[model samples]
Target: MSAAAEDEREEQYAFPMPPAGGWTADDLDRIPGLPPHTELIDGGLFFMSPQTDFHMATLRLLEFALVSAAPEDLYVVREMTTKLAKRDRPEPDLMVVPRKARTSREQTWYDPSDIILAVEIISDDSVERDREIKPRKYAGARIPHFWRVEKSNGLPVVYVYELDPATHTYAITGIHHDRLKLAVPFPLDIDLTEI
Candidate 1:
């Protein structure tokens, strides 16, 4: 591409400037031209990177497995944000939320209490947010369960966590290499190798 054309394209897609105190969760809805799956964390906007083959495959596998195993009362959603606070809204890769939480088809976010489990699949660019920042925020919000899926030798390794209500923190419950079997947040058995 010619330098002039490239410059024009960049000008067309310039990043949005944040407000004085940074962006609130509600700003996400009003912001135009923002990338899809944009998140608000600590009053800042986070744009997502392109999805990889491994990320897409693993997300599909987990969604299928969870949807099939979840009880009638629960619903599984992908890339939906849970509002933890006024300035904090982060989209989990997959979430198991109560069916009753769906107030309307137009609803774009869920309350932290409504989410039973939040899963994040790690990516090269998302290592810090997926592994540390998001988990801390989720735990602080008292989300019951959190799962971090990491790539290991071209396969997946699931690290499961359960919230400690007293301390408002997450405790590592189990790390499943081949199969993920859990009792809390409903009975679930998934084969990690399928990813």
Candidate 2:
């Protein structure tokens, strides 16, 4: 058949939910009606948050800026599954993983060892979950850095966490107003206002 038709098969993992409870990675593979892509997080299932016009526009601009500003080798992805060992697996809103990292080709799930920075862009319904639960999980995974973004009120708050040298654990180190500045994991000169 055609290459596009073959490509479609690899991406489909549509499964219906049972009454309640968590799903194993195997269950994820069995989903029969899943949309284009998805990520499993915190023992719960979520379709990637629907993108609003502003959010989509903002993300596209930011994606282009980050790629141009970083090393030619850097990669950016949205709603990527990151394996947090057997206890949990999370797909944050945006993740800057190594160049050419492949989800489908993986021998094992994406682990803390593979990530540089993990990010969460808060939607109106998810502030508490992003600030409290998810960051703790990222810290536990010992992922070197975590970023949290808030894009609601005219200005969005962005926080960055770097592995703290003393504790050898992730700690909040910088706060960049997403509006005032598209702070970090970015080329230093690209201005948010330009987007």
Candidate 3:
């Protein structure tokens, strides 16, 4: 195709412009042609890049482990946004929420209070957000528990953090490289090598 023709075609498929105050959390559901796992943070929309094999394998391993270990009252979910504020709705790679918090099958997001644990598996494109930004936001929202998984030597390294309610910050609890054995957020004994 000619350069001019391609430019015109691209303009026709351009994403919607943000409203006066940028995009709201609710706007995520209404936006058309948005790629899957789109998030709203501080009134701005963030689109996720395609997943890698490392990201996918780690996510699947954690999700399966969490689901198997979670109590009957807690539910495991993947790629579901958590509503932290009007403009801050982030989709953790995997989340453990209260079974009762699920309002309906159509529910797109969960309240932060309903989430017991939020896990983010680091991806090349999301290193900064997973390592810093999202953890700060989740801690501020007092989500209780957060786990960040990083790929090292072709293996998953899990960094666990517990929210400090008084300071609204996260305190590092443990960093598990091989076996993930945790007492809080339910008893979890996962073999990271499986990923």
**Comparing 2 and 3 on TM-score, the stronger one:** 3
Candidate 3 deviant stretches above 4 angstroms? none
Q: Give the total clashing residue pairs for model 3.
A: 0
Q: Estimate each model's TM-score.
A: 0.95, 0.72, 0.96
* Model 3: pairs clashing at backbone N, Cα or C within 3 Å: none
Backbone-clash count (model 2):
6
- Model 2 Cα lDDT, one tens digit per residue, 24-143: 544555666766445556566666656665556556655665566666666776655677755366667667777756557543345577677787877665667778877887877777
Per-model CA lDDT versus the true structure: 0.91, 0.64, 0.91
Q: What's the CA RMSD for each of the models?
A: 1.5, 8.1, 1.3
- Runs of candidate 2 with Cα error greater than 4 angstroms are 1-21, 103-109, 165-169, 178-187
TM-score result, candidate 1: 0.95
TM-score rank order: 3, 1, 2
Which scores higher on TM-score, 1 or 3?
Answer: 3
Q: Which candidate do you rate higher for TM-score, 1 or 2?
A: 1
Worst 10 residues of 3 by lDDT: 38-47
